[model samples]
Target: MSNLQQQLNFVLEIDRLKAVYRQAMVKSDNNRFENSAEHSWHIALTAQILSPYAEDGVDLQRVTTMLLLHDIVEIDAGDTFAFADQTALDGQPEKELAAADRIFGLLPEQQFIEIKSLWLEFEAAQSIDAQYAKAIDRILPLLQNINNEGGSWVKHGVSKTQVIKRNQYLEKSAPKLWQFVLEQIELSVEKGWLKPE
Candidate 1:
């Protein structure tokens, strides 16, 4: 097949993820359901916009790649929240690996390898770029919850302690961005977007 055809096939494969939307148990300003694809796009854009604020030097391109591909696995595996325990993550790896093998494998050989590597790297959160990408991933949900007036937190009966614990990874991985989240959490609590203890 021609490169265009291969690219087109790969792009079409991602449509499956769009079918896998998660509305955060909250809603956006438009009050629409946010799909996994939409979440990935927001994270990619955030990574590009927030790259400069990274606590350390970063490869923006790598971060963007990680953001875009990280959740393609959600196409098959579904999204699990940060507050969920390890029990939820169980079996997710196998599901996601199967999804990645099929979806990313749609691309041409080199493209498939590139995307798969980025996906795995993001999952590992070992690389500098992966760390920042994970930070963006976590930060966006917190922002959404804050904006939607305790969307997921309220639904899950998540405590402030749980919120802090769930998002604490941000501090070590991306201090500045994590600090911003802390500030927003404080403001959200004060404004009643979050319930006080």
Candidate 2:
């Protein structure tokens, strides 16, 4: 096989990413929460739906691609929550970054660089796309928590205050979505997903 074909073959094998599927806090009606694949697709669709709400100009396509590819590292390194305490989230970038290099490097070099750049951009939240993508990244889990009665938040002992803090940036980038999230938080409490604190 040609070098190009080898890279293509590596990319085509979807089995590499499916070692385990994590439920998104709440079980879906199907008794399964969304997996990383569905999460990726959802964010891409979110970029399309929420582009107009982005506070700054964003390349929705780029944001979507970044969201779709960003979590592949989690396949190897496992996902650490964004609101995880400092130690859980910190001083461990090396492991995940190296994993990103390996998994993304499996693609052609240009794709590796571009995807890596997008992931970095999403992390830095420096660009409009990055910031908007970050909002989606944070917002989706909150939606799951609300829908599933605080699935992860309840499971992980997270407080409503913590959820609000993690969500505050949504107000800056996507006020409309942020408003919806706030309402959802209130409803989750009313629905007994969150015990009032």
Candidate 3:
């Protein structure tokens, strides 16, 4: 196939991401669960808007790109709830890596390598860009839960301690955002949205 055909095919295949539902509900859409595609878009925008607060010298464009491509693997491996226990998460990285290989392989060779590299960088969350992107990614779900009266936290019986432990990395990537998260957790607990233990 021509490069154009390969690119177009990849684009068309990724449309399936819209159908992959996540545990978090859309805050503005009543109680509807958010899809992977929407989650990607929201986090990309969040990265852009929050970039100024990221570590000095962070690349906003790369962070946005990482956020945009981070969840494409969910199209195949499916969405894993953030609160799932370790048993439920076993082998998820391998499954997602396989999905990445297949999904990204749909692109032309060079494009595949570049996109896959960005996805891997996001997964590693080591670089400044990836760290900022990851911080923004984690923020959106908290905002969704807070807006929807603890949307997934309530449904999954998640506690404040669990939420903090899961997202503690945000403190290193975006200290200001981490403070905001802490305040929100306290507020959520006060509102009876999240368990206090």
Tell how far residue 127 is off in model 3, in angstroms.
1.1
RMSD of each: 2.4, 2.5, 1.2
Give the number of the best model, judged by TM-score: 3
Q: What is the lDDT of residue 148 in candidate 1?
A: 79
Residue pairs whose backbone atoms clash in candidate 2: none
Which one wins on lDDT?
3
After superposition, which runs of candidate 1 have C-alpha atoms over 4 Å from their true positions? 23-30, 187-197
Worst 10 residues of 1 by lDDT: 23-32
Clashes of each: 0, 0, 0
lDDT to native, each model: 0.79, 0.74, 0.88
lDDT of 1 by residue, 41-142 (tens): 988998888777786667898888788888888877888766677898788889989989988888889998988988898888777788888888888888
In angstroms, what RMSD does candidate 1 have relative to the true structure?
2.4
TM-score sort, best first: 3, 1, 2
My TM-score estimates for the predictions, one after another, are 0.86, 0.84, 0.96
lDDT of 2 at 180: 85
Q: Which tens-of-lDDT digit does each residue in 61-133 have in candidate 3?
A: 8888888889999988999998899988999999999999999999999999999999998898788788788
Error of 3 at 84 (Å): 0.7
